[model samples]
Target: MKGFVTAGTLALAFVPGLASAAEPVCLTQAEATSLVAYALPQAINGTAKRCSAVLPAGAFLRQHGSELATRYAGQKDKYWPQAKPAFIKTLGADGGDAANLTRSLPDDSLRQLADVFVEGLVSQRIALKSCDKLDLAIDLLSPLPPENTAGLIALTMEVASTAEPQVGKIALCKG
Candidate 1:
C-alpha cells in the first residue's frame, strides 16, 4: 500500500507543469483515468530500470516488469485520445507558449515526446530504497485490468485533491 503512494508520485512526476501552474488545471474523471492508463506502463518500466541494482533477484519488477509494461502499453492507444486533451489543457495552464508548441506538434510526435519525458522523469524521481516496496506494489496490482489500475489511481488523486486543494497542482474535477 505504501508503494501505491510511490506509484502515484511517479505518475505525478509526469506533470512537472502541475507544480508550477498559476492555477490548477482540472481534469475530468475520464481524462484523469485515461492519463493514468497512458502513463502507468512507462512508469513501471522506468522504475524497473532505475531500481534494478537494488531490487532483489526475485523481485516482481525484475521478473515481470517488461510483461507488465507490455500489458499496460497495449492500452496506451485506447487511452491516448482522452489523455491528449487533458495533457494539452495542463500545458495550457502552465503557459501559453508551451501549450502552443505542444499543440503545433502532430499526435505521433507529441506521443513520442511524452513517452520519453515520462520515462525520464519517473526514473529520476524514484528513490533507490523504495524499489523493493514498489516492486511488491506493482506485483500486487498487476492482476487487475489496466482500466481498474488506472481508475484506482485517478480515484486516489481525486480524494487527495478534495482533501488538499493545492493552488498549482492538478485536480480531478468533481462531477
Candidate 2:
C-alpha cells in the first residue's frame, strides 16, 4: 500500500508542478480529484510500459493495463473542465510566462499535450523493483469507479501533505 501511495505521489509530482521558490498554487479537492481522474489512465499505461520487462506475463499491469486505461479514459472528458484550469495554473506557476503559451492552444490540443507529458513522466519515474507492487495495487483498485480510485489517491495525497513539513509547489486545499 505504501508502494502504491509512493507511485501515486510520484505520478502527481508533475501534475502539481515541481517544487520551486515561487509561492505554491492551490487546488481545491474537486480540482485535485478531477486532475487525478484525468491523469490516472496515462499513469497506469506509462507504468505498465516501463515495467513490462520485469513484470510477469500475467501481472495485472501486463494483462489489463490497456483495459484499465480505456475504462478511465472514458471518464476523462467529464473530468477535463475542472482539471484544465488547475493544470494550466500549476504549469504557469512552474514555468512562468513561457507556460502562458499553452493558454492559446485549443482544449483538445492542450489535453493531448498534457496526456503525453504525464505518460512520459510516469514511465520515467517508476523504479523497476516496484513494478509488481504497482501491478497488484492497480488490480485491487480496478474494481472501483475511476472517480473513487482518483478520490482515494487525492485523499492519500492530502493526508501525506499534512503529515510532512516540506510544502510542495502545489497544495491541495482541504475540504
List all candidate RMSDs to the true structure.
3.0, 3.1
- Per-candidate count of clashing residue pairs (backbone under 3 Å): 0, 0
User: Against the hidden reference, what TM-scores do the models get?
Assistant: 0.83, 0.83
Give a tens-digit lDDT track for model 1, residues 1-175. 4444665554464354443456777889898788778888887888898889998899999999999999889879998988888767766634577767888899999998778866776788677877776787778889998889888777766655554333226687878
Per-residue C-alpha lDDT of model 2 across residues 74-173, encoded as one tens digit per residue: 9899999988887776565446566767877889999998899778877886678777777777788889998998888767666555554443444677
Judged by whole-model lDDT over C-alpha atoms, candidate 2 comes out at 0.74
lDDT of every predicted structure (CA atoms): 0.74, 0.74
Cα lDDT over the full model 1 = 0.74
